[model samples]
Target chain A: MKDNIKKSYLLNIVGILSIYLILKLLIGGNVLNRYHISIVIFICINIILATSLNLATGFLGQLALGHAGFMAVGAYVSAITAVALKSSGLPDTLMLVISLLVAGIFSGIVGIAIGIPALRLRGDYLGIITLGFGEVIRVIINNMKSITGGAQGFTGIPRIANFDNVFWITIIVVGILYALTHSRQGRAIISIREDEIASEAVGIQTTKYKVLGFAIAAFFAGIGGGLYAHHLAFLDPKTFGFMKSVEILVIVVLGGMGSLTGSIIAAIILTILPEALREFANYRMLIYSFILVVMMIFRPQGIFGTKEFSLSSFLHKLRYNQIISPRKEIKGDE
Target chain B: MAILQTTELAIQFGGLRAVDNFNISINEHELVGLIGPNGAGKTTIFNMLTGVYRPTEGDIKLDGVSIVGKKPYEIVKQGAARTFQNIRLFKNLSVIDNIKIAYHNEMKYSTLEGIFRTKRYWKEEKKAHQESLDFLKIFDMQDYANTLAKNLPYGKQRKLEIARGLATNPKILMLDEPAAGMNPQETYELMDTIHFIRDKFNITILLIEHDMNLVMGICERIVVVDHGKIIAKGLPEEIKNNPDVIKVYLGE
Candidate 1:
């Protein structure tokens, strides 16, 4: 078991480095242009968003709809922080890191504020309250022109969150999230999802776990927002509206809730697919949604269901051709 | 010494007194059966005892401390745990994980320790894993440890629920119709399991079962309720012969 853990850790580091190096090489050689590089960065940002949202909507088993509200808070907070820190003579990278942290912490605080009240309501009520709160955030940002620049959009951000920063951030964030979901705390969170009453009956503080999960999810969504703010050097209250929230939800649902690997894979495919289909022009959205509907009808559990895609397991299966379901084997034996 | 005591505990759902004047006292290591006909407020009493419902009328004392309006999880932490009448395993989780969740509160590692994977995380996690396996071993369910709860056979599911309830390390474990769906052989095995667990864990047990053979065969004392009232209370044989119990439940 120790050896397996070591092997997986080594494999993960190698895999991450390879992807980074390949992308870096592409950019250096100009195989991918500026527009394509931006799309890749967007994929990373969206992966962060989808995985963070998955913690609440997937692992926590709550239908949260206002994730964008948290992201909006992060973007605005980080943008403002960066603008203020610009004249402080700090190194660009350090300033960017601090701004992102501030963004995440503030977003998490807001998440806790909203979560305490909103989490008390379950299922659809929770969803609606989060949605309402999300809209409230957008409207507040829209009205607070002096600070947010309101409907006019906030620009002149540092543009420090390049592909170099975002790819690594996405990897680190997802890795931390993976560790979290596989731990003792993650069990409490998942148990709530599996059976809330049973979880409560077994001495889990359901309300505390729910709020904790919500706050963590919100915190990462804020980090994703911070990355976006600098990458594009812009912030639009309109970008963090209801439709944007839906866009992130679509990615998570498409990836299979509770599966972080699914979120990353789905985020990549969904982000790149539209860009690849830009030639279709007017019929693009219709085609994209049509594909989604078909995918849902055919495979409703999304790409991976609730199962994590394991590279080791996949390789073992390839070698041995063994069946995965123990129940099936037991039934057959009987 | 009463480990669990409830006095005049009652709840009314919109003027319908579902359970009124309910009183129960069980000593440590006692295996007591709560028997009642359908809709006799047996489950409701369980709910109130476990803090699922706040009783409008009386007080519940666990180990001589009043526990009214405390949440169900809090009650579990205070040395009480219960299984549902309808089996409610974490169906999506593995069998061992179902038990591990009951051990959630007892594990001391913080969330930050979990995220960072400190040495304490591995030490505690390894201990939890081995112990959870030990728990499954008592039920002789070690082989099915990795199987999802939903995929388990009906009898095994019932046993798993009992295992999950016991996992909380409760002073008094409550079983709600544990043998409800089991065959005769399974019920016999469950009866033995019930007796074994009560002695092994050295905990009091409050059982709500319709199977007279299992309940009467194992329960040291029996309390019978009918229409939200205690019809009779005594040894299982005494309750079996009691006129009120016979008229309401036995139906001679």
Candidate 2:
């Protein structure tokens, strides 16, 4: 048992360092250039957003349509903070961190406020309310003429987010999310997703867990939004509108509701697909809608469904390797 | 003495009183059965007891404290756990995770610890997994620890539900028609499991079962109901011989 844990820990460290190296290579790689790096960063941000939304929608089985609203909250809060604090001579990295934290806290607070009332509402009613709340947020941002710059959006923000920073943060956020979904609390939330009554019977505080999911999703969306804001050095209410929420939802559904790896894969594919089809940009949405319809008809659960790729499961396959090669020293035989 | 008591508990939907003025007292570690005809308010009573619905009028007391309007989770926290008539396992979650849901009430780590994977998180997670596996082993479901709940057979799913309830560590565990769709052999196995759970855990059990053989063999006391009222309450032999029970069963 101790050996298994030690091996797992060591594997985790190696995995982190390798990802760090890959991220550095991606950013510093001359092959793809600057535009591709920006695209990669944006893809990471969307993956973070969609994965967080999947926690509430896919794993928690709550249809939330206002995720973009949460993103907007994070974006604006971080934008305002970075701009206001820029003169204090704080390091750019510190400013970015503080802004992201502010955005997370603000978005989380808003999420809780919206979640408290909507927790009791079920199914489509929840979807509608959440959608309404998102719209309300967009309108609020649009109407806050002075601070948000209204329709003109918030601009002149510092550009602290680079490919490397965004990449590291994305890895951290993904790790955090992955760990959470596999943890005990994640199981409680997923139980509620399965059947509310059964979950309640098992003594899970369904309301508390539901809200926890929403707050956690909001926190990540805020962080991602902060990254987005700093990446662009400008923000607009129009960009973080209802359509953005739908786009994230598409990523989640296309990925598979309860599959973490599925969300990441879907985010990457969807993010790049539009850029790849730049010639038919207007027809891209039409094709996207058509694909969604087709997918729903044949495979409504999405690509990976609810399966997670576990290291333990991979380790279990080592016996087959031994069966194929009896004499060779198997790495799994340690 | 009764650990749980209901006084004149009533629930109504429109004009149909699903459960009317239902009263029962359950002692600690007692295995009691609730039996009835098709619409005898058996499930309604269970729902009321578990706080799925507030009684239109009445009092449900746990350890002498009224809990008529408490939420389902609050009732659970007050030492009441339950399994549904329909198996309701988190379909996508692993068998171990299904049991871990029940342990949520006892988790000491905050959201911060969970997000950060702090030391406290590891401690709580280790405890939760070990505890969940302990319950799973009772039903010989340890091998399928990582298998999704929905993939399990019907019998295993039923057992998993019971295991999940036990994970709550409740003083009172309620089973709603556990043998609803089981085969004869499965039903027989379930009866043995129920007895084992009652004796080993030393917890009170309130069960709803249609199978007379299983109920008679295991239940210390049985309560028979018709429409929305309790018609008979006694030992298995007494209930078996009750004219009112016969009438309801025969639709006379």
Candidate 3:
């Protein structure tokens, strides 16, 4: 069983590294242009946002709607930190890491601050609270002229979140989320999602796990915001508004709630779909909405439907030459 | 000595008293049953005893600790776990995972440790996984470990719910209707399983059942309630012949 675990881990590592190296080679060879690289970075950012939100909305069974507000907080905090640290004579990589961490920490703290009061409510009540809180954060950033530049937007952040850096950052964040979602803490959170009352009766503290999930999701959203700020070299408060939260949520729902790999795949497709449809001109969004409507009417559980894609499952399918349904039970070493 | 004892326990919802003056005591390793007709407040007593509902007046001592203001999870941690009147297994989670989730408080590891995949996380998780399997083996559910709780047959779901509650290592197990939707054969099987678990775990049990045969067969003692009050309390034979119980059941 342990050997099976090791082999599967090896497969996953190889799979991830090959993808990263291919992207790196594409950029090195200029096979993909600057516009494509920017899109790739955006996809990475979306993956981070989607996976974190999946932790809260998917695994914890929450309906948080203020994700963009946390992202905005991270962007402003990291941008300011990068600007402050740029003159410290540190390596660019070191500065990027520090700013991202600071951004994540501040956003997570704000998450806890809001979560304490907000998490007390459930279902639509929590969603409304988070939506209102998210807008409030954006408004605060828009009004604070001394610090946030008001609605004019903060400019000239150090552009350290290039594809080379952000691709790896995205991998690390996703890895952390996967590890979390597969452990005891993850099961506790999932149990709360299944039935809050049953979970409490079974000795799982629902409120703590709910808040923990919310804070972690906020933390990752902040990290994604930090990456975006550096990638764009500017901070636009308007960019992280209600619609932005809806977009991230759409990725999560499109992927499949309670399925991490589904979230990743959905984030990738949704992020690139608009660019891929640019040939349609004015009909791009029309086509996109049409697909979403069709998808909802057909497969409302999302693409994966609470199931994940895994290397072992993929290998088994290839060897057997048949599609095997996703199994929940993985042997030891999981 | 009584492992679980409640004194004058009562709860009122607005103008209506849901359960009042409900007193019961189960000694260590005792199997006691609570029964009454529909809306007779049997479940309300379970709710108050399990901390789901705070009694308007009275004290509940679990292992001699006053658990009046504690939350449901805290009560479980204090060594009292319960199953709902309705089947409340984590429907989407695997059967093994449902048991493992009950082991959450028992396992000692931080969220950071779980995220980092630290040594302690693996150690605790492996122990939990193996123990959950062994735990499932008792109910002969090892074959269904990977099956989702909702997919289990109705009888197995009730058995699974009981098994999940036992995973909490509670000193006392409060079951609110373990045979709600089961046939005679399944009810007999549940009776055997409940009897076996009480002996194996050496824990006190308080059961609420509308199925009088199962209750009278397994329960050493019985408490009957009607209209938010205890109508009678004694040995099963006495409860079987109680005039008040017959009146409550058959009407006037």
TM-score of model number 2: 0.92
Q: What tens-digit string does per-residue lDDT give for candidate 3 at A1-334?
A: 5677778788888888899999889989999999999999999999999999999999998999999999999999999999999889998888999999999999999999999899899999999999999999999999998898999999879898888789889888988998888888899899989999999999888888888999999999999999999999988789999999999999999999998889999999998999999999999999999999998999999999898887886788899998855555543211
**Candidate 3 wrong stretches, greater than 4 Å:** A322-334
- 1 or 3: which has the higher DockQ? 3
Rank by DockQ (best first): 3, 1, 2
lDDT of 3 at B203: 90
Best by TM-score: 3
Top lDDT prediction, candidate number: 3
Ranking by TM-score: 3, 1, 2
Q: Is candidate 1 or candidate 2 better by DockQ?
A: 1
**CA lDDT of every candidate:** 0.89, 0.84, 0.90
Order of quality (lDDT): 3, 1, 2
DockQ of each: 0.72, 0.59, 0.88
User: Which residue pairs collide, candidate 1?
Assistant: none
Model 1, residue A113: C-alpha shift (Å): 1.0
Predicted candidate 3 versus true structure: per-residue lDDT over B7-104, tens digit per residue: 99889999999988878778998999988999988888888888788899989999889999899999999999899888999998889989999999
TM-score of each: 0.97, 0.92, 0.98
